[model samples]
Target: MPKTAALCISVLGTGNIGSTFAFQLARTGQHDVTVIARPGSTRLQQLQRDNGITNHRGEHAELRVAASLDEQQPYDVVIVTVLAHQVAAVLPALQRSAAKCVLFMFNTFDPEQLQAAVGEERCAFGMPFVQAHVNEAGTLKATIGAGGQKSRLSQQRWVAMFKAAGLPAVFEPDMPLWLRCHSPLCVAFESASVLAVRRGGGASWQQAMRIARGVHECFVLIQGLGYRPYPSSKKWLAASPAWVLAFVLWLLSKNFTFRELLAGGVAECHALIGVMIAAALQTSVPVNVAAIQAMNPTA
Candidate 1:
């Protein structure tokens, strides 16, 4: 009988999100993991010296650290979890690697460009269902998806491994659309929060609630466009009425950790909001376009 292949994996970034993913993967014991960061970078060094990483408050520890692709064998799955803009620079390196399966766990409106670059057979999209960020001490914190049936069987196996490790993992359908749906709303809320912070107008608590409401509005705009929001995450977020969403927002704001860690990126928040609004305006979704225009006369 032919031997089954082992899962060799590499994460292409070491930011807060990437670190959390790597830690989760290591804890799972499903794959041999490597973290790929910029050459001569200190993040990798700190990761190594941490004497194995831990998650869920040291509930699990996996003794692996960042390494270059050159030091390791070819990966079975190369997960590219870098910043959206950093994807292109890593493409050529990825193309040269021996990894057969490449998964992108990020937001990109243009999938065609990436597919063309990596070849369709080698690529998959990973849509993150929960939100998290680094605290003042730079610890990575995030929640995993609820695990739906959106991904293939093999993909489910990978997600299950993370779930075993204590990070929530789930499969879902239309992950890209799901990812996009959240981005717009997140961006909108970020916009309001940042604006308030800069103008010295709204309190942080008020801004957080407004942004949560804004996120709901983005989804409303999306449904207005006649495209059904990705089924699973939408169901979770949409389960709450506007009052609930607003209430949740207020609750999240009261927690200082949520605001300091997750709510500070004003520029990014604005760009995402702009994209969602522009997409609505340009598309055939009359209700979304009208809603956006109605809310923002500048549009």
Candidate 2:
């Protein structure tokens, strides 16, 4: 791809993350953005008819929408933003595409399977810093973290492309570890939120302490496995007093906005917890994750 010519980017999955990305790319007009959704998807039809998708702030842009990946006309980059549990279903399709780089932009405790599916050379990993959701009206309401900054696993051509489009991108050298460390904290809070639902109201002090303890254990387990918690911010869980952290968790759990988001992602949260627990067990590190495990007994 030429520096001056627009990059051909295909965003697979039409969920909150994918749609938000596609919208941002379209607004930049520096790339030929194509959004691929499953056939028979009403969202795809709406996007095609309207020539774009709208955001909660009423922002909109015209962009291409497709139902399948174009094998013959290769894309410069293809971003996969589906749920982690759903990644396997799309691997074969992505492997058959001629796109030079395929970026997986979702959470997963294990990335080896993805790396194996798409040849490591062509695989890239990224995590969206934005929190977005599709409302009933189908408009995307998103809160871009740190003013639209995103984290990538490496510095590559795709990173340059993202930066050129006004999306700040930073390279995280230990991304796999980053994701692993992140999983526990994410699962703990989300699990606590679900527990709140079971309790028939907001999060209680006991539930908050349980989550804080669970997170602290995860941090210990990560260290026992010979890896420093990636993203130093997580180190706080280990460094801070238990009561302090629990208080913070309690406050977050009571927030209406946070509860709403957690409610919508309960399924994904459970799946991630299962994967994280499995990974921890494999390390043979005697870490007590009972609080976390109790969140999803079936898993």
Candidate 3:
């Protein structure tokens, strides 16, 4: 952990996921992690006062603070952990940044647009399977992934880097297709959780089955667009019995922690479903748009 040997990393966005990454990286003492919190915001001020980030476990991580990305600053890697909707706003700055690589870590369906903005060579895509949420107490509550799952990244170099930093990550060669395939499931579960939250607990049998149908139809829509369900899990999900998926979703909805993890995902769900719906119009395959819309949580 020599100062000269440490990687100079910058993370944009100080929300739950961003804070979690900054904390984890700084805690290793192997990276000089600096995170961007909005200038003049309470969040940035609080971090400055605390001198670091504190997780729910009461662990503290001392990291450098920044009001915004300094395009001239020399950074080894700049990590973007913002939501899908917020990414576009930061694209210009990220494009001009001196960082060698910009890792866009989040769920994104149209990664080509991002790559184009920053030059394909400078962009790295990843799907963070990390589950995280910030509570009213202002401490991040997070997990890399429950049940031994690792965050999936497109670059093998990033996979190895994250592993060395004490964060489990697996290299995925085809992240775009993997993310596209994952959309139906992501939207389904988030919508289901939103509905379940409104209904007290768990999606009803009818709603669960409806969500299952959306998954099946959405996968078909993906195929109609000429993309095979990229990963085998998605292939199986589309090909498997609807009742089985319904049962599993229903069971998970009843799990308090599982539902809570997705409860705050309304906006992300909306953006994802919007993409799916728009893509649906391009194909003749029929998607139960009304059903999917009903399952979707409005902004």
Candidate 4:
């Protein structure tokens, strides 16, 4: 008989990231995917009825949904995709379960707190590198992660699974540092896009340039912190001067879709920038403090 191992996965959030992930796994026809949403969430009920999920340029067929952590046991891996606050509650619940692997597929720069809560043996971090959203109609799209970095051996299996599922992914040794460098640009550009929208600024090719500049600033900061900068679509940032970064932002403001898709989404960009600022404050690294400070809404 062939050696058989059961791989069970439960995602702790049912919004865009969670639902989309569930769909991704289900499409693989491998791991048994269960989405744990708040009890009696209408959206969960609707998803259960639809039994389907849509991704960028493709649609995943029907899959099952689970509404509680108590419904399953001995989960092989527990993927948490909830908001920052929701993580606190979910952590204790996981402590009550028999999950052997717990991976956070979203923002987790603060490793100490997470390791303390979930135990390092079961803890891992994943940064999905794509702009995605779950509209009111329950459609999903944009499932991608860092194409530039690779995770440590400790995380290769899960990374391999994601790659096999056709999602762009990589497992990095220094996940925190990678997130630190990756998230700042994402946050700054999106937040700036939101600001631009309010000013009747549309997203254009020019706007893409601005977003690229913000990413460059983050790259500079990461290099200052002694980490390799990850690759992004912001090629202009690599070839141009800092002033050119500012100029690109001016151009991007004319494109409506960029503003609507990125700037108009959740406050992830703000949170990312906040994490970078906190890290800088803690380290006393003043690489782009003035530029970062100027971008601060309250500053």
The lDDT leader among the candidates is: 3
Sort by lDDT, best first. 3, 2, 4, 1
Q: lDDT at 290 for candidate 4?
A: 53
Q: Candidate 3 lDDT, tens digit per residue, 115-231?
A: 898889888988877777777656788887578879899998777777776678899999888887887888878877887888898889888888887788778778888889979
lDDT of 4 by residue, 1-299 (tens): 12123367788888866776677677763567777777788778767777756655666656656677853487888888885535777777877778888887766445557777778888788865555677676777653554453223238777677766655565677665555555655565566577678767653444444455556656666666666654443334545675565565655655776667666434555555666666666564556655554553223
Clashing pairs in 1: 147-170, 147-171, 148-171, 150-172, 150-173, 189-211
Candidate 3 ranges with C-alpha deviation above 4 Å = 1-5, 284-288
Q: Which stretches of candidate 1 lie over 4 Å from their true place?
A: 1-6, 27-30, 48-73, 108-113, 129-154, 164-166, 188-226, 232-247, 277-299
Question: Model 3 residue 25 lDDT?
Answer: 82
> Candidate 2 — which residues are off by over 4 angstroms?
1-5, 56-59, 145-153, 196-201, 239-241, 297-299
Task: Give the C-alpha lDDT of model 1.
Answer: 0.58
Error of 4 at 66 (Å): 3.1
| Cα lDDT tens digits for candidate 1, 185-280 | 455444444444454443344444555555666677667656566656565675566556555555544455444544566545544555566776
**Would you list the rank order by TM-score, best first?**
3, 2, 4, 1
Pick the winner on TM-score between candidates 2 and 4: 2
Give the per-residue Cα lDDT of candidate 1 at 77: 79
